[model samples]
Target: MDLQQMRYVVAVAETASFTRAAERCHVVQSALSHQVARLEKELGARLFERTSRRVRLTAAGEAFLPAARQALEAAERARAEVAAASGEIRGRLTVGSIPTVTAVDLPAVLRDYRGRYPQVRISLRAGSSERLVDMVRDGTLDAAFLGVPPGFRIQGVHDRELAHGQHVAVVAPDHPLAAEHEVDLRHLAEEAFVDFADGSAARAQSDQAFAAAGLRREVAFEVSGVELMARMVRHGLGVALLPATFAAELHGLRCVPITNGPVRVERLVWSRFTPSPAASAFLALLGVGAPPTAE
Candidate 1:
């Protein structure tokens, strides 16, 4: 009839004495008898035989005992599972990130997350910053890594700055500028530049920097992926200005720091109310520490 009723039936069957069963159930013997009587009536069968000396199960009661016990066990297991899911972290989390973070640091972050919550499934998607932000806004992704654009607007998103790193000049190893320890904007003003797509955060920041320096540069090529831009730079197509993470990772392309002033910061962002425990757990792993906090 109900979980409590099933539990009552199980206790009565196990103990075989109304007074003892009532004690086990933490109820008075009269109340236990009334509920058991109600269940037997509901099922249209006698569940117990009573004698002055002892109590025992009827044939129907024996047949129903295992079923009632199993039902109670199943209900308890369901409750435990739901409670665990609510309080303990375990589920699939869809994460989106820009090309630079995905290529450079995300592997370590994900590996640590996997080690911590092995039951939490992680689905990672890499895209341009704009696309990843759109995915988070549209509920397609639980969280993401993004380079927050200057004056960027999002209705219900929250972000935390994860790390600060410089934008470096990446060029072919054999290129003359690659030999320079650091590059100034004035030197690259006349050279062709490999750029992130026009609307991207990196491109926007780079444009602002060039504008501040009164330097006009040509976009010799455009690619969405920072890694691709670096590879193109390696082929001597043109030079690129990308996040230091990507530059540090590109073995074939030399990364020369650009230090006119302060370097840009990268951030991890997500919806203010992401609906996944796995997402929350991963953010917790980020844990409000210094730059590149995953470790």
Candidate 2:
């Protein structure tokens, strides 16, 4: 019914103990209990079922929990938005990125943003695109630099291709594949390969490329990051198909272009709807979320 009540309910759901939740909320156990009781009475449903050993949410509580938490979060966001509107862009801004983007692209943008808006706190999370998209959808991040995987829905988020690059075969300097100027997907079919783990944008593109070429890649090592894959390849673990730019940057990694008949394109993606102010500024600087300039 109220923000305080919603907060109390969410705390109880999270901690599962009135005393602990109250302590976290900097309120007494009695007050917390009274607030939750008041909320339950207003809703005409029991929120929690208390036992000697533990407290559990009732079916009604479980159903109401998400909405209650969201309401509380929205209220807090509104307050922060008001504070931010006072001509000071000051609040925590969380941005997610795939590893390659973080390593290769984001530093300059982040540096510039920090110089311009030093009061705004910026936090970065580097992970696979799958994880980044989930984080953005769940409000964990204000926005993200995502690689558009083929066949995924892109409706809720607005995406534009920021920079385009292609997949390439990376190998050790002394490895046999290093001598090749460019290699086809079928050449790596019989070779031991270090492939990205599932859910990675790079892996999704590579999978599609391999499938189109009617070839099966023998994945010897399934790593999560491009840097790690390049490192493993440098040590002769196996060859991997990664972003050509990322592979080229690693000193010891030799990048051999993958001629898969059709080139794989990497896209920088961001959400279109309701991106936070900090995110909007960063996207604007990157020239992806804004209108074209006159020549």
Specify the highest-TM-score model's number.
2
Error of 1 at 238 (Å): 0.5
Note the Cα lDDT for every prediction shown.
Answer: 0.75, 0.74
lDDT (Cα, tens digit) per residue for candidate 2, span 171-266: 889999888998877887878888777665667777777788888878888987666777788889888776666666788778788776224344
Q: Against the true structure, what is every candidate's RMSD? A: 17.5, 5.0
TM-score of 1: 0.65
Stretches off by above 4 angstroms in model 2 are: 15-34, 41-44, 49-56, 102-104, 118-141, 149-153, 172-174, 178-182, 197-200, 211-214, 220-237, 248-254, 259-264, 288-295
Candidate 1 regions with alpha-carbon error over 4 angstroms: 1-88, 102-104, 149-151, 288-295
| Candidate 2 lDDT score at position 272 | 44
What lDDT does model 1 reach?
0.75
**Candidate 2, residue 233: how far the Cα is off, in Å:** 4.6
